[model samples]
Target: MKFKVDRAPLLRALSHVNGVAEKRNTIPILANVLLEHDGETLRLTATDMEIAVVEEIPSTATRAGAVTIPAAVLFEIVRKLPDGAEIEFNQESAEEPLHLRAGRYATSLNVLPVDDFPAMVAGDLPHHFTIQAGELRTLIDRTRFAMSNEETRYYLNGIYLHVVLEGKKNYLRAVATDGHRLAKVDTEAPLGVKSMPGIIVPRKTVTEVRKLLDNDGADVEVALSETRIQFRIGSILLTSKLVDGTFPEYSRVIPQNNSRILRVSKQDLAAAVGRVAAISQERSRPIKLTVTKNHLTLSAISPDQGIAQEELDENSVSYDSDDVEIGFQARYLTDITDQIDAEAEFALADSSSPTLIRDTEQPAVLYVLMPIRV
Candidate 1:
């Protein structure tokens, strides 16, 4: 295939695939990207059997043809090229190697027949939804930190995305957990997803799509089927396989009715945990939060560094009991607090129990942090 393209657009498209392509694959063709030139536009496609991406960019075409080239090598070459240089690619005759030229520089790369490249059928994802790009970014940011990293329990390695009705109104809820802590965020369900089944989006896909959401105002076209999902925005298309196992019924984990409550500023709570977490090492990191009446006291005790404490000014807050001390991974507590976008909120339940965190002004999101005993 023969076509010429600008360095910037090609580089941007390849960067997304570079992360998805596994270094070790049974088939070498899986390691390469299929490039098809159809006179006016060039299509770049990559897949690892689980997810696939296809992006089309405007190009100057010579003779129409297609080939498979190592995605990483092509990306690196174009990325390092001097700016504003028009790239010319040609495979004029099957007898010759693929030729690349820009200015006085030239390189030849071995090519494979494009027909051998694997085919990716997107499936019939008839249900398509449109959501604000920035809103999707928020859903991912608030909950992704809690997704399970353990691979053995493959079901928990993704964010659970589904439609929910709270107070008899529709909303989109994202929930993630790693057995230690859990994060759940609720936003108004985008216009078209009210009836779609709840789906688990894999962690890898989440990380990739998050990067694409940079253009906050961009609208995302999302589609879902039984086995695969398609996310489209402008010229970008990301297709990924959904997890096969059933997601644990998360509702059982949420506290039904908890009476204990403590309202504290998110900023202050985050700072307090971060400060005391300095000496927490390994699994025992900064581990204590003691709440009494309107006064909040944070402390951490470590065998190596001993103990430390900090006090916060009191609010009108009152507790259901005398005093409660809860130990948490200083990092986990800090992370949970960072998800809260409110100044004042409550931490429900006792130090020995799972705590529910809520924002007084914004009740849509609920955060749960499992207490770690020191």
Candidate 2:
């Protein structure tokens, strides 16, 4: 195989494909990337069994052939090469090392037989739809933080994506929870998605797909089956296996009739929480919130260190309900507040029940947080 390509495009393609290839692999071929040239364009593919990424770049190929080379090694070499340099790749046979050449640098990489690379067969995908990049980004950014890392409840380790029907309107929803906190966000459902089955998109797949949606104006084509999902972004394609588990009915956990209401500036609340949480030594970093008629106080204490408190009066917060005191993890509070734009609304029942939080600027997103003992 022989081909010539510009450094910038080749480096970009390698970087994307290399992420799917694991550094340490029990099978030798799983650590390598398959490169195929068809005398016009070059195709690069890498897979880790669960997920696969494939990208095609325009190239000038003198011969049509294919080979597999170490993914990490090839990526590093291309990334370090001089920008705008024209790179040449050549190989006489599968048994020979692949030769690479730039302006003043030359090297050869050990090649594995292309036949040894396993192909990830994407079986028939019946459901097809398209989504705007910006909408997809919103759905993922708002909910991924709450995804569970605990392996015991594998169902909560991913974002649950499903279609919700209300009368004649259809909404696409994404929900994630780690038992202590939950995030739910929704957007208008695209056409042809109403009949699709609910699927749990694994955490790793969510992360990789998010990286590809850099251009908000671009449209992403999605096709899926019960077991697998595929995303086509420009010239790149990503296929991943859906998490094999049933997500719990999340609506039962959401609070319905919380009477107390408090509205506060997102920036002010986040800053005060950070200041008080700095003094706490506990792993949970519990912070106490005391809300009275129109005043709010945030405090944290540690037996060995000290106590820190910050107060926000009626000018900074708007509250008219009865006094209430609640404790919550500092990290959880910050995570939910980060998604809010200007103001955050808290609907509370008491210090014992779960508190519902919402972004005042966005009505379709909501969060539920369980209190921690102070």
Candidate number with greatest TM-score: 2
TM-score of 1: 0.92
Q: Roughly what TM-score does model 2 have, to 2 decimal places?
A: 0.97
Worst window of 10 by summed lDDT in candidate 1: 313-322
Q: Candidate 1 on 1-374: residue-level lDDT in tens? A: 77889888888888877766655898888888888888998888888888888888899897888888888898899989998888999897766778999889899998767777888788799778998898899899989999998999888999999998878789999999888788888899888888899899999899888878878898999999767889997898999999887788887777766676788777777877777777657664846767777787788877877787888766534454567887878777777777777565655576667788776766777777778877
lDDT of 2: 0.94
* RMSD list, candidates in order: 2.3, 1.3
For all predicted structures, in order, the TM-scores are: 0.92, 0.97
The all-Cα superposition gives candidate 2 an RMSD in Å to the true structure of 1.3
Candidate 2 residue pairs in backbone clash: none
Kindly give the stretch of ten consecutive residues in candidate 2 with the minimal lDDT sum. Answer: 15-24
CA lDDT, every model vs. true structure: 0.82, 0.94
lDDT of 2 by residue, 261-309 (tens): 9999999999999999999877899999999987899999999899999
